[model samples]
Target: MTLPYGRDDDSAAYHYINAALRGRDAEAWRLLAADSHVEQTDRVLRAMLDRIAVARTHRTAERATARARAAAGEITQAEYQRDAAEDATKASKTAHFETLLREHHRQIAQAARRLRGDDVRDELTDLVLALGAAVDAHRSAVLAAGYEPTPADEALWARLGELDVPDTDEGRTSVEDLVRRHAERQDDLGRVLAGIILDVAGAATSVPRSALLTEWKKTVAPTLAPEQKTEFAAKGKGSLATERLRKTMGHLERKGLVKRSPDGQRLDLLDRAGLADVADGRE
Candidate 1:
């Protein structure tokens, strides 16, 4: 229908089409260009179908690597299990995509052979129509597999801007460090508690759970702009923030910046300066 896209569009379709046009499959252009039906069928429609397949393939490879790493004990079994479930969902979606994808491939190959003047069975319209229904589903599956965000991550990311956290340069470098803890440990509450715990500790060498929580309820909770204190503060017996703080503190200790007492009564900041950098989202 039209020439392959230039460098401006980074869409997988454009890139795939361009690659086919300029590379080994250049001959495909002539075959597709021969008939209006062929050209239209193999253009954007083909690109969409192929892009979904490619995306699903890349996701499969990434999950394979994660599986290998989990087997070697490079990541926790719990983390692995969570990821495995997500991957299974992706794989299931991919299986559905593959069914439609293979059908389209069969149809296109038949079209190509027919273009070569060979008698080949084909059903372009029916196959294309079926693909429309599956397109959104395929996109959702690929996107979820690509990013791998949990519900906590999505909420925290939204709240980060709402809370105006890291209040430093509005850039990825700082925010990524804030979430990642300088590539040390990352979890559900890990994204937020770094700053809250730091603010609670102030210049104290040691902080107990009671003192830390008291400061959180009285001091930090008041300063926050957002009204979602339920996740960030304990009201009566226990809270999400309470458990998150406990886990985040354990993460801090593993980073070698904090130490927990034998009885878990108090925690000592071992590396104050480094901890500051960690909490502030700095290198």
Candidate 2:
């Protein structure tokens, strides 16, 4: 009998059945059963029935194989029962983990909403702490199961330390304010770091200022709150505008206006040359 193995729809099955019948395949007609309501049966029903039948056949064959193995003394009944129980336990654990992951994502979404001030301040703090604990627990469980946490997860946990939840309401407010301030400071530091990286590493291989600016806007800006963004934007502009300052300093050092150590770590600023370079740049 020809089955609709590759057919995606009833039309395809109909074509296959017609072709089989035209080729005088009696088994195909018997499989189709003239009294069966093919019009009422959807392709999904047929596919599901086929799958169930295949599963049943597999179970029967497996049972027979197991019986033969037991007869040959290749496996014990106790061993087979133990293996079956282990498989069931593994499947249950997998299902439990899937549920936990779904809950985790749901909780994170709730925490994000709370972060946006959709919930009470105290409630938001509790939610954030709960979410963080859940994530840490999940990470520990996965690691225990021999799965390594991604670098991103590790980075997040490190950043969470900077979040430092406080007990008192005043302390919590202070912590939140500190987080905002630190984020701004980090952005300003990043600009300095990017400029320093360009200078010390040489400008030819460095990312363009425009690209760095775009990266800063996309990555560093949103890390701060909305109000903090306005405050930090001015600071960032000032820091970024000092890009030529490093190069000018290097030039002055070469001219004996500044004495830099071999490693460029310490700078002994020579007053005359430093003033001259600054004056020259201004001119």
Candidate number with greatest lDDT: 1
Question: Candidate 2, TM-score vs. the true structure?
Answer: 0.18
* lDDT measured at residue 160 in model 2 versus the true structure, 0 to 100: 53
Q: Output the lDDT of residue 82, model 1.
A: 97
In candidate 2, the residue pairs with backbone N, CA or C atoms under 3 Å apart (3 or more residues apart, or in different chains) clash, namely none
Model 2 off-target regions past 4 Å? 1-119, 169-283
Q: Which regions of candidate 1 are displaced past 4 Å?
A: 1-192, 196-202, 217-237
lDDT (C-alpha, whole model) for all candidates: 0.54, 0.47
Clashing pairs in 1: none
> Cα RMSD (Å) between model 1 and the true structure?
24.2
What are the models' TM-scores?
0.28, 0.18
What's model 1's lDDT at 173? 30
Q: For model 1, how does the per-residue alpha-carbon lDDT over 1-283 read when each residue is reduced to its tens digit?
A: 4545433344644455445533636455554344543535444545555566568668879888998999999998899999889888978876775455444444454454457543321143224323432443344575678977667656644543333222224533323334334234443334345555577688777778777666545544444332123212212224544554676777677768788889988878788777767666673
